[model samples]
Target: MESGERTLITLFEEIVNRFPHRVAITAGDQELRYRELDRRANAVARRLRESGTTDEAPVALFLPRGAELAVGLLGVLKAGAAYVPLDPDHPGDRITWTLKDTGASHVVTVPGYADLFAGSGVLPVLVGMDAEAEAPSLRGGPPGAEDLAYVIHTSGSTGLPKGVEIEHRHVVRLFDVTHPWFGFDEHDVWALFHSIAFDFSVWEFWGALLFGGRLVIMPKPVARSPRALHELLRVQGVTVLNQTASAFARLAAADDGAERPLTALRVVVFGGERLDVGRLRGWIARHGDAHPRLVNMYGITEATVHASHRPITAADLDAPGVSPIGFPLPDLVFHVLDEDGRPVAEGVAGELYLSGAGVARGYLGRTELTKERFVELADPTGGACRAYRTGDRVLALPDGDHVYLGRTDDQVKIRGYRVEPGEVEAVLLRAPEVSAAVVLAHSYGEDDVRLIAHVVSDEDPSVLAPRLGQLAAGLLPEHMRPSAYLVRTGLPLTPNGKVDKARMPAPTAETISAPVAEPDGTSAELTDTERRIALIWQAVLEVPRVGRDTDFFDLGGTSLSLLRMFQQVNSEFGTGLDITVLIEAASVAELAQRVEAARAVSPSAP
Candidate 1:
């Protein structure tokens, strides 16, 4: 609680005063200590104040995931304005979208991306050694308890993204609660795995600064690569390994090449998804001598990073699936309630609501949505305490903990049966041949939600598709099986490194020929040539199905995918459909006729 007086500004003051000369951040061969970061941040902060940017204004940060981003973020906070992080690796459209939405007055970016925002009217402040050392123009007022610290925008599955406004008090509370749990000390060296845009990076940033520990920011390539991450762990002397479940799974799945003994790993914190305990045990079993502590954290962006966590051991893995997220932080309260707003019995799945100081103020400029998701506790302890309905389905376990069920909205009804798409996708990903999978409700007049598998292996979808369906049948319910299987060299990924479902291809009627031949098959019969062309449509648009009259772009097909499709047709069928044909003849029937006409041309018809 003493840290309450020490806001973002105070935290930096403490570091500059106490550990000025201590090494603060290290990226590549470059090293910066506390005193340098403090001085640079002050200069940037002062420059910001002179520009009339105050506490309420948001400054956009488009620096890479390294020291520049760290400095810029701290500087923006020092200027008493919230910082909006846009990953430099993201597409220009994504960055432009966030910038325009946030209404950021100034953008701090490298010289490379300067031209990307040319017409945005945002003042570009280039980050370099000079900007870092410039003296702060004037000291800004300190941030208040409820003052906005930062705004993190989450990709909305349904529509445009919404920014979650986090306050200083929320950050303070998270640090206070998690500090005691981790028992971090000045000697700790934690690996920073997440991008600056995500809220979890706050944990890696403040967690280190608050405890005077070392923060080793992994290079983007190293962070994404399992082998590189494993190597960094051994080389960097990372005592605390924090990553998402996806990252953990990859690390745990890696083969035993030259075992990089993770002897220094005191704690491994995993979150962002349901971790497979089987893989956890298997990973530990192979590296038994390492004896690292495994901690599972459960939290939301609405809450300042993490609110609950539990440590796991080899013995705990033997009991069942992944363990329940333990009780809330000491200063927080987590309740499990049923639909009628009554407390549920242990082992009964209910909506998990969180009440704590760590809950964020609300969504930025979205009071309606904020009030909808975060409501007053049905069982109130009086006074202004409000509980955030996490929209997460969880249960009170017999062991006095909470088990995380998938999201309530996450489950979709397919053919009148409820199916968790994530559950099916998890099974699909488990197949060594499959690199990624996504299941969505594909409407074909029957409201049949089809499962789509995007495999990276060289195996043919015709042979592998049936085998995968068989595998799913054995492991999942009949309704959970993917109606159609599609294989690709790679799955489309958004700039944020998540599966870009919107970019997935459309399913053409012809590609479903195999199942259609079986009579009970949902697909209609189409010939071999038609089937081959239909596959091109599915691979390009990422849609569930293409009707005879369905348009291509209307189904989320893009010009880039169309170009690739034209090339595929040329290589495989000795016919290249005019790129303009996609626009002129949007429907499959029209496109098929056009393709037939194209085939009539000779190779010499340039």
Candidate 2:
């Protein structure tokens, strides 16, 4: 293939030919060299092709984080098909919805995750990685650059996940244009620290493989535990890391009093959420910005992971509380436009419209949404060009940089996931008793944000609230699930008869506490340990009070918030506790029990 005409498949094949002996991926104790990875993925491609999974076919990968995940992603592309990654960790309903929407004819999964497709309708042809590839070589050569590479699903404002159609060239040019800024090479080791369903993982995996680097697939347990993840980075010699700002905050705090610091990381790029520069003060004091340079990138999935980038240093800590996304890539341009689509003056806040090589091919099977979000405008050359309208409100700087303000709509980002409050509200409104529902996002800390749902119902709060909570848990993922569900007799409305979101009451102890009562209408008071734990939860969650039995997730606690809460609990109690403990023990009473159990075995136990 000509160098200028290379797609992801061709580019990756070139890398494989050049570095066949180099280790390409590491997951757990298993490692796959470029030669082995190529042979394996090629076999998968052959099998897919033999099974009639041809060009532009949407093959869904419903697998866990493993070498198989990479194999599936590459294999689909090698078969001239676009891969659709489905997070196994998400709610089953959501997974089913994605499968049906994408109309995937094949699924790349393992035996352990085979059950994920149980409720996904009649099921696609289940192609396991373990299946020996006895088929012939793929007939067609690699797909063209304009061919669809992947279809990533993003939460939609209309209560569904919209599949974004990204072409091979769009993603290839992302790194190609930014190569000068970051000289990634084979020597670097990167961590696949995000869910494959998330776009950040696209940057993580491709960034490593395209440059002949080693990519480590972080196990779910290790990914959730800050202590374990830090140790993994140190032991695995990870050099390039990608994280959401909130996740990095917990990681920095975990590194605070460590006997050994992570010195291998050379580039820590923060994306997925608006970075809070203030969170990096202590890390700067410890590591400085020389070795592992910090970068804050502003982007959305539609813009192919990142559009703008700025270095974050101690110098930024001195500036105002602003998130500065330095500038767009050389090939990408931004239009800070008013509601009427007119260009706004520099330094004036407006919705960010990104256009250029980074813009994807628009939403799959969503012509109306695609037209609404991705609009056409006159380019400098006088021809029409397409741009993706990011709902983010940004102030365009004279230097072509952008300072992120906030979102223009009700959508809010929680732990790097773009969540549409209306999606959650739509789920809540499914309950028969719910007359009206609104989901709101609130920040309990600088980086810790959570979702709160307010529902209008005539039913008793105690009986109806828990049902809504259970319903959301069954239908929504942990990040999208509301941390708290408040019951209201009636909703506040505006002059236009719309729910006056501005008038929605800020979450407080009494307002949030109205949702629950004992099944017998009698509750136990907080014990000393439970009270201490409650106090810590109250402080970390920024709530007035946390009862002994209050469910952590029901209180609007997210994985990031749980991490922050545990960091404090572990410090105060001098116990090594994993954040995953919340999975089984979420309430203050349950966590206190585990805390006491850990203390019993500790030398500090009295």
Candidate 3:
């Protein structure tokens, strides 16, 4: 790409021209080669152009994981528009707000979601239907390097999600800088495991498409199940893979019990959450580090997905408790500074500030916040430059690497998603029954961190628990939902009149919402299958008891929790459960039926 002409459209066109017959994406049994994907995307681009969407317009993609999603993303970019992906699993209210917030004039979805935006003002471009029709040519040239490519909405402390406006130049430079470390080629096959709503997907998609590699789009169920995902990696011959530490830990455990190791993999990248170094030592003992090298990265959305990369070696296993994230990319620069804006010493801990080629344009339509977080600083060259305040604390190593500590703000990471306690608290307070709410992250076991919401309300804790759970289900994403709710008439306050979080008690096992009896005030009866599943749910969901009819989601069971439950279920029943099994089973009774059917169909040895 030329200096000022680098753009997704330009780069993608080059790939299409280079490898038109190479398979670009694989979703289920359907495979789309480069030429076909380009044609499909062009069809979408034509529809958007006909819909009057101009360059740099924010286009909402409200589709699930499938071929249509891929078309919508590529098509939006082809139309010179920025795509904003919306998780279909999220509540309708949140999706509505995101569309309104972005002022999106167009929404790309399938026929299944036609009713979702019947009277909504935006023009709905149904992918399956619209892309098949004949349309007029696009109106203008492709979007430039400086134009917005995507707006990723992350958790905001102000009770809503904030859109981080990333430009094409930022993303283009990302691969340019990191391509040396990862010599990705046409022979490589990658997995689109994470949701497109998350910034991680940016790397997943571009990393494969840019280098003419095949990208396998994992189904929702397959992505959640460690065993299922490992099987897919082996069967699909996946070479390049990226995962969060929490998710990879489960995959590693699954690999341990597998009959054969996945030998096709060339590189395994870890990011999103902190790494457990001890876990890697165990993996290295089995797989060794030479073939499929381990690389740990630390990054944020504002920095266009990744900032620093640390290649893991046997020596890194003995680096004490610190997670050393190696050095920043060539195009990016990092500064560890104190609150006074002065640079801290090499070994001192301070806030991490990043600046360089990948620094985002700023928060969408939020000038005040853009000014506050994205501050101007003096470059080493003695000129002014923009830098993003990461809000994470880290200390520079003697070798110029940075070791991650923890967050310095109210923000926390749940699974791989960056969650804001204030956002969850605000959602809780939306209910008239909740007067005051506080959400905090609590660690139960190793790598089992969850959010617990403590509320001050007049209603009884038992009665309020279900109501709060239902309310949260309709207002926030699964990761943002509180696992447990603790109610109090009034919270202990400090002399300063602020709620003293130190005095508040964590939810004890007894206080957790556990079903003791049936709704009819009788003792619950469970079959053998139900009992086994109930026990698994009890451990994974952190509830003392799971009734026959207890809804898995009502208890704040997220996808990660469901994954943990599936591992135990597969171990006990030897069913190797697929996600479709859970399609009819959101409760213990329903799941037991599915489990029984699965066990009878293809039971394997435990």
What are the root-mean-square deviations of the candidates from the true structure over C-alphas? 14.6, 4.1, 4.4
Q: Candidate 3: deviation at residue 350, Å?
A: 0.3
Find the 10 residues in a row with the least total lDDT in model 2: 513-522
Candidate 3 regions exceeding 4 Å error are: 128-137, 513-528, 536-541, 545-606
lDDT of 3 by residue, 574-601 (tens): 8877653452367888888888888777
Best by lDDT, which number? 3
Tell how far residue 372 is off in model 1, in angstroms.
Answer: 0.5
Task: Give lDDT tens digits, candidate 2, residues 1-606.
Answer: 564587998889889999999999999998989977887788878877888887998999887788888887888899999999988877777877887898887887776777756755433444444436434348477798899999999888888889999999889999988788889999989999999989999899999999999999999867765667888999999999999987787677567645678888999999998876877888898899877999888888998999887988888888647889888888888878899988887568998888998798989999999999999987778898899888889987776767899988988888899999888899999999998899998776566577788898888876787677678767777688776678888888899899888888668655784433322334578878788888888777766556677666556565557767878888888888766554447678888999899998896843
Would you estimate the TM-scores of all the predictions?
0.69, 0.90, 0.90
Question: Which candidate order results from sorting by lDDT in descending order?
Answer: 3, 2, 1
For residue 213, model 1's alpha carbon misses the true position, in angstroms, by: 1.7
- Please, what is the whole-model Cα lDDT of each candidate in the order they appear? 0.68, 0.82, 0.84
Q: What does candidate 3 score in Cα RMSD to the true structure?
A: 4.4
